[model samples]
Target: MIKLSGVIITFNEERNIEKCLQSLVNVVDEIVVVDSFSTDNTKRICLKYNVKFIEQKFLGYIEQKNFALGHASNNVIVSLDGDEALSEELQESIITLKSNWQFDGYYCNRFNNFCGQWIKHSDWYPNKKLRVFDKRFAEWKGINPHDEIVLKDHRKAGKLKGDILHWTYQSYSEFNAKTEYFSTIAAQAYFEKGKKAPFYKLIWNPFWAFFKAYFLRLGFLDGNNGYIISKETGKITYLKYKKLRKLYSNN
Candidate 1:
């Protein structure tokens, strides 16, 4: 069986860290947590579990995750957010995979909980993430706050059963705050990449975002949660573009 190292990066994640670590108790061989010097009970709660905790400056999301990946003692790594945990079936799936070690990378579906609602649609369910992988083959990439694992040479990937239970926003206030934070990062990333948000795109994109999520994606099936997601999806889209435009105007 291959030894698996579970890695997570956090800052002030006291509310979620314990649950995240508990879920990995029997699933991985070791747990490594790289924290950004949280001044909260995040570090205190993490100490309750058998985790290798290290503190570092607040790096960008992608950089911080890559930094956490570096501290893993094993090459077979399972990276998860502090707000995410393995479902029962996912734990079993990983346990089986550990015994065989078949794939270089494994993709799993993530089910998100938004404001106490298990969002099944609204572009939320079946949110496939490549969280488990051989470190030598993959690394965290993409813009900050929207990092993803990119495999070298476009290697073949395997799918895992079950889900990563993502405990997302528990309130609209939190949702809006996170949206603004992510939009700022996204706008800056776009500006650095020489990408522009034209006037039309600034207007039409949000409308399309809402339509795609609510209508095409069948988000309405989730009721109020779906509506909120669709609405916020548009809001985030608008904010990203608006911020991008501001970045250009300021120059």
Candidate 2:
């Protein structure tokens, strides 16, 4: 059987770290947590479990994740965020996969819990993430706030049944706060890549974001939570482009 090493990056994740660690107890042979020196009880909680806790400087999302990957003792890795945990079915599927170890990587659907609601739509459900993989074949890539694992070659990938339960936000205020922070990072990333956002995009892109999430994606099926998500999605779009425009104008 292949031994799996679980890795995660954390910063002030006291509220979610325990749950995240507990879920990995049965699935992974070892757990490694790379924290950005959280001032909260994150380290204390991590000590409760048999985890190798390393305090590192605050690197961007993609960089931090790659750093965490380096601490793993095994090449077969199960990477997760501090706010995410494997569902029971996913744990079982992973356990079985470890016994057989067929594909180079495994992708699983993530179901996000937003403000106490298990969002079924709003482009949230079936949020496919390639979290489990062989470190030799993949690396974390993409923008700051949104990082994904990219395979080095045309490696074989497989899907697993079940979800990665993502405890996204506890309140609307938290959602907004994250949006503000993430939008800033996204704009900076875009600006660095020589991407520009004009006035028309500032106006039309947000409208299209709302329409696509709320209408085309069938977000309405989630009721009030759907509306809030769709609205926030549009707001984030506006913020990203607006910030991008400001960045270019200032230079």
Error of 1 at 40 (Å): 1.4
- Candidate topping lDDT: 2
Point out the worst 10-residue segment of candidate 1 by lDDT: 95-104
The estimated TM-scores of all candidates read 0.98, 0.98
Q: Give the TM-score of candidate 2.
A: 0.98
Score candidate 1 by lDDT. Answer: 0.92
- Give the CA lDDT, 0 to 100, for residue 160 in model 1: 95
Local distance difference test scores for all models: 0.92, 0.94
lDDT (10s digit) by residue, model 1, range 128-246: 99999999999999987789999899787899999999999989999989999999999999999999899998789999999999999999999998999999999889999999999
In candidate 2, stretches whose alpha carbon ends up further than 4 angstroms from where it belongs are none
lDDT per residue, candidate 2, 1-251, as tens digits? 89999999999999898889999999999999999999999999999999999999988999999999999999999999999999999999999987789989999999999988899997898889999999999999998788999988899999999999999999989899988999999999999999989799988999999999999999999999899999999999999999999999999
Q: Give the TM-score of candidate 1.
A: 0.98
